[model samples]
Target chain A: MGHGPGYVEADEDMSNPLGLKAKLGLDVFKHDKEPHITIKAGMAGDQRLKKAIIVCPAGLYSENAQGEVELTIDGCLECGTCLLACGSEVLGWQYPNGGAGVQFRFG
Target chain B: MSQASTFDVIVVGAGLAGLAAAYTMAREGLEVLVLERGEYPGSKNVTGGRLYLNPIRDMFPDLWAKAPLERHIAHEEVCLLDTEGAVTVRYDGAELGTQPYQSYSILRAKFDKWLGKQAERQGAMIVTKSRVDEVLFENGAVVGMRAGGEELRTNVVIAADGVLSFIAEKAGLREPFKAHDFAVGLKEIIELPRETLEARFNLQGDEGVARLYMGDVTKGKFGGGFLYTNKESISLGIVAGIEALNEAPSTIAASQMLEEFKLRPEVARLIAGGETAEYSAHVIPEGGLHAFGKFFGSGILVAGDAAGFSMNIGVTVRGMEYALASGYLAAQAVIRAKQKEDYSAAALSEYERLLKESFVMKDFENFKDSLHALENPRLFTYYPRLAGDVMRDLYEIPAGPKARIFPTIRKYFSVGELWGMGRDMWRLMKI
Candidate 1:
């Protein structure tokens, strides 16, 4: 049988948003720290940030009840969609620490 | 010497382009350091499985014997999906998969790490998981980069930093990727029994196949789906235009789109009873030359996806080969510059000369018009329906008299529509 690190034994069922993170196999930071990507808190009312809430492919960006930016960095795919959605003024974009973000098991 | 002055070349991103450039430079006796953002080289990368060997073979002959390649692709399949049916055209040839094979399916996590190791074997320092935060410049020349709060200096900075290329942006080489120029690809690696996968794809040991789907697969958007056979799994995915998706007359989430695609009888047949091993999403540049920016600046050169080196010509979506080629050329230019001890834009212009002479520029410039033709709505929506209607007409027997072939074909695609398709074909395939 052809077997190696890239191959994984799979289970039936569509991977949901929560289950998707596990499949990504990202190595998490040991300590609670600031995320590499942050939505501009002061610019929460900015229209671009508002639109980024829906445009982000990972669905990691959202809006609070007050229609402000709410972003979750845990499952960020690092595709840079949010950066493109909201430029430097409203988004802080950087690669996650050496080895602590979205790691694709089969990319 | 200080830590910043240790290396001659410091490459950000340990993907294929970075590795290829490092390997070439290191082999030529230059001090090289490669910084990777992922836990490993390939962990942050993805592909549709076909890595054209021509460029790699040109760079490193006999690489296939040791590379972590899955299978040699010998069969090329094209399927067009419609509202209710599909039409497939298959090509099987004996001359394929011979020595110096054309292409193969590969898992990037293994193959890229292998490429990284190859470069490491040649004395390249590959620092995995270290993401370069910024490219430091001096007097309009790139001097080095800072990563993880540490600064490292080098004579040249090669930006093989994938599609987004924050490093390239730091050098002022690229603008923020716009949705119109980008396409988001979502894939599922579905594991299956080796024998089952072989049988399902109609292949013997080691032989593989690839299929590209047009039409309803993207829900009528300006993009397509692909299935590439790996050893124990199938790399199945869809690439849809992000801007098109954003403005789609009707739309659903990319996750929903993939789930719906998996339900299609045409797709469901291939992966029946299989399980999804992993799920992934990435964004690729599909705007041809329009997506490209300045590939070079003083003391810096951009390669791979970061340099906008990918091309999607309908029949094939190619990036890795272009990445390898650009990386190799960048190294050649770097080697030449090192001899002269000048890393200015004038010295780096040799890299552009090499690319212009190679398949990198020739192919993209040759196929530039297809980038426009691919956006034609008919190819994705109306034409696939036409194909389905034509297939249905040809297969189903009517109780009455049979119609002539020309009239039957014309009925599905009228004369004007045929002329329009002819123009699209002419524009896309003129090269």
Candidate 2:
């Protein structure tokens, strides 16, 4: 009975921290066709973008082998953490259009 | 049926603040419209899972009895965690368990949806899945807003939007965002059986516990972790300052902090057999009154996180009560302006005046220096380790001989450490 909608069983991986994708799977999201956030062109290699890799609670930001930061918006929590971490010059950020993005059922 | 293009009031974002303002004004016979950018009122909301009601109870006098509150908090705990050991202090006061309880554990998704219903019952028209894209201005005054590609007119607009308040920015009421002024929080709602939760938390019927963890929980960051016992689940999460996470000597994902916190021996055993029901993250305005910008503008007012109402004073963290109270006061100011048939900046300044005279402004003014005082790195690192070490040495029995109690405790407090402690204490006096 404790299992409600969107509940995901905790994985048994103890050696590694809970994977971001699995944790995001526990939330309800209404997908949007267009990405709501993007790393600004030419600014992907900006040092400011490095903060996004560390401060994004969803771990949506990562540095590629090219030393450029990349972002995936599928699991964006709409928390605005990355925006706050990386200034507007390096990231194009906005909330997903109305009714899209992660929806918290037990927030 | 054609909906009116104009409303007496348009409150953006259906969190606590917007709902409170809508409910207050609708009950006064005003045509209030609340625009929400989510599937439902609380669908985009998140909290640390507790609301302090004593400060806001009188503002919404009749709503508490039937509110969707999870449990009345009867116990308060603080856990200081080092890399290895921990020190915890629990307070179970008789007054805390009595009627007229001070606070309750809350789940915003449930409470906000219920609040929207209450506001509707009071004649407020709520439009869900409607995002306000722009603030409409006439002669440099806010006249309405554009949402869902439709221009909606209103005499005044209330920006009750959450922390990252774009509406307030669009209306020219806030300064540019600063990383140091905000913190990000990540929470997981872990579900368990009611009996198991009750037994684990030592709770009676409808009783709950609220615990805060510091030090290693955030990896010595400027924030901490929190756990609140719900009726049949637990809300566990971490709040780390964005600046702290960014400026750390090494890179660490904020989510990893929560993962490690859940594995701490002191926390792992409590929820050994629970399932995670939901995961959420939110940005909190932690800069205190110093970060507050122009809250009232020409025919526009800001409330809740949009106005930077949240604060962290080491022992307690609060925002919801301020949100609810500020929303109520904003409505009162609008009602007063309606009587004069004016929505000018001069007229709407009453909102700021009312806030200054209320507990909301008084509390902010009283603790305006809290955030700065808490920025000292020692509070998050040295102190916790010192506490854990002292406790360990005091309780541990040596192999052959036990050291004298005074020396065992006194050895850690060298002259330099004592001086640092004194300086920290003097800084905290501002709060």
Candidate 3:
């Protein structure tokens, strides 16, 4: 089926894959001075860390040029999908202190 | 250690469970303190935006009259989709539209904030922007917790934290996390004009629709997509098994899956002209009874997602009611313990007993195998595609003579496929 009559696009920008940055920008967030999550030292290349790339809803995990997994904590939904996909051994995860992380207005 | 910081009972997290516990206890003249990490009660809470009231209405007898519910769901639908086509089944029963409606669409931010106010009015003290940093123990029993560098003490502590509860784990009530036991959901609250939303969904005043899509929604993963009609917005989202998403031959980011799902013709038309108001994600505890660990410890109790209270059994997904019930029951157990001057594990075991005697545990026992049954990949992939292909052939009016309907449909159900279907049906019967 194709778009029927009277179909109005929600937003032109939505037609494109709303990248991680743009999707996260739609919600409210309070930035923390220090990232709440970090790849444990010397475990960046661990196989377990790779799963976060697929399961993190915000798409916060990615592989660098060296094929080592990297993570940016901004826009982290604090869903803990990464921590479950990758074990605690490869990632040090915690909710941003007290009131520092995301503040969802419509959750 | 000061008496000013101590309370009869302290509840962590201010979602449904925490609020319910505080409301129940505070109403009974027991001092109750609720701690929430977010800016407000629901700042970090998420749901598909529907709540079944039949199970919880009686539990909170007077609360529904003025609750800020969005709409009463009058339509139930399920859609099976393939790459090119889709099959949809809609159910509209007269009873669904009658008074004392079974369920209603809800927004957590609005609903939870109102519930917080109700709890506060009942004499419960709630402190927002406070996150529990440590679960303190004395003589191997939880006595209190530390939050925001302040040590708060209480006679009993209730861990009503959401899924991925650090409080539960730190108190030795839950085991290490397992990927197979959870699913991640991403949702967008797309706002539409009230008139447009009602007309588009064919809903009358205060009427709403709840639709679920399987198959291509999750790219054959073990999860599905859900849409709920709110008063002026649609809650559209996809839930995918973390393990399935991770172990698939080709990896696709969860965020990309949502974007694609919205583009599907069947979904796109429904949401046309809507403006996305917000985007949120949260992990759901879908592992059912098998994944449950200890829910109570000495001087402590676990409730809500923290205790794995959510369940999905194809047609209905429930959690909020379970959270409300469990929190209420936990409060009951604590009240009993306080009367006897006991906060030990043996006394708190009453919480589990109360659950087993209620619908909360009974429902879990009945459908404990649903998660395993839903894990079959063919249910999400092969079946939807087969149904779509069969439908396409049956509906096509070609240039040549049309084939007989029975034969055209029968051709695809080979003996092997029939046997496989039988096996899958047998497995499903267990739930």
Candidate 4:
């Protein structure tokens, strides 16, 4: 079963009308929209790094700290732990290309 | 008749669905071959790691005595969490701890691999690391499949290749899945000492609790998150609509959303010292009635995720059970088709009949409204926001005389401005 109305729409005032309401339109923001990232720490903006590294950290959808598993097990969290560990700036950590990543049945 | 070197039936994918099919076929004296793409049968597979025992027991009588089960859960808890507070419902019955009932937590890598071995003992040939490239057809009838560039012919091909089933698409049995048809599930298996797990969750030896967290898990973006207990590991995950995440703002990546969930004061308390053991993600088919297509066609039968048999609407993500059931039914259909010397789509249609006759299709038909109900946008959007809004006022504990409950209740209803709660209630009733 899903959250009872008692649980989901519990407090009316505690809710922030801004971020809370905007986040509701995830579908509108995701596919129809795209994200713009300004890379400052990685390789130079113009120069092409020879290695196209993918930083798949321990938490496939979350970042991890230093002492974590480095190998990819089909379900990497994209946590950026390895990216920070590698520090090579070669690892390009982003969500799975598309249609790939974690799924949830309820929120 | 073509004298193929292989066997009468070739079951592709040694996951639970495929293994169930192969085991059933072999028991009936049919030569069955299970080809797995993974290095081992379940090595590439992952699940929430809990198995409701009744279904498994129905398939294999007294299976609990022999199946490779991890632990039988004695307790279950459902916790509804917001950014600040949580409300929990717990069900603990000793009866749930015993016979013909109760669910066991499992690791697919171990469970599926063991089940494959069971099928082998029953005379099924399981070939691992053999990816089925395509299904072979002669005169527009499925005869076998291509594995690693080699053609292996058989009487029937059972497609149980999971959510992104390539074989189903290749055979023209199904269309490509849309974002609305599925959810992307991410999970982490965190390991805690055996004693710690029991103590943390307030459980005895094998008892466990499964918690479902809503609200901030996906940063209040539609889908929900879950945490289930195993013997010594906790399976934590977040699953959301693919389209929803694509729509979120750039400041919050999906990963950061999950981070926000774990970092929440309520959720963070649970996994305080646990070390992460494994992380995995798999596409879960959430499409209910609208997603189910033809169950069989052209000398082949589609089972499990390939047929969009997953039931993912709040209560449970139920493809594995349906997979095992549909796979067993498919095998029976193939056996009948072989006996009648007919592998036409009409003959394979029996599989569909059996599915409808079983809980697989029956439940889907019964709860068909769930798809539209969940997709209504109000559940995730308006509901969570309104809930957080009201609770903010109700929970303020004052040191002086307690504030009258009437004003807070009035405030709660007034701020939920859209449609009245009555409309949502009516919609749920109609669904």
User: How high is the DockQ of candidate 3?
Assistant: 0.47
Supply the TM-score for candidate 1.
Answer: 0.91
Which candidate leads the pack in DockQ? 2
Off by over 4 Å in 2: A1-11, A14-18, B1-5
Total clashes for model 2: 0
Please give the DockQ score of every candidate, comma-separated.
Answer: 0.39, 0.69, 0.47, 0.04
lDDT of 2 by residue, B139-245 (tens): 99998888889888889999999998999999999899999999999999989999999988889999999999989888777999999999989999999999999
The Cα error of candidate 1 at residue B277, in Å, is 1.5
**Ranking, lDDT, top scorer first:** 2, 3, 1, 4
Model 4, docking class: incorrect
lDDT of 4 by residue, B318-416 (tens): 667888888888988988987997889988899999888888888898878776666555565456666665666678778787778788667656645
True contacts kept of each: 0.52, 0.80, 0.73, 0.01
In the order shown, the chain A TM-scores of the predictions are 0.68, 0.84, 0.82, 0.28
lDDT of each: 0.81, 0.90, 0.89, 0.65
Arrange candidates by TM-score, highest first: which order? 2, 3, 1, 4
lDDT of 2 by residue, A3-82 (tens): 44443344445324345677787788998979999888899889999888888877788889999888888788999999
TM-score of chain B of 1: 0.96
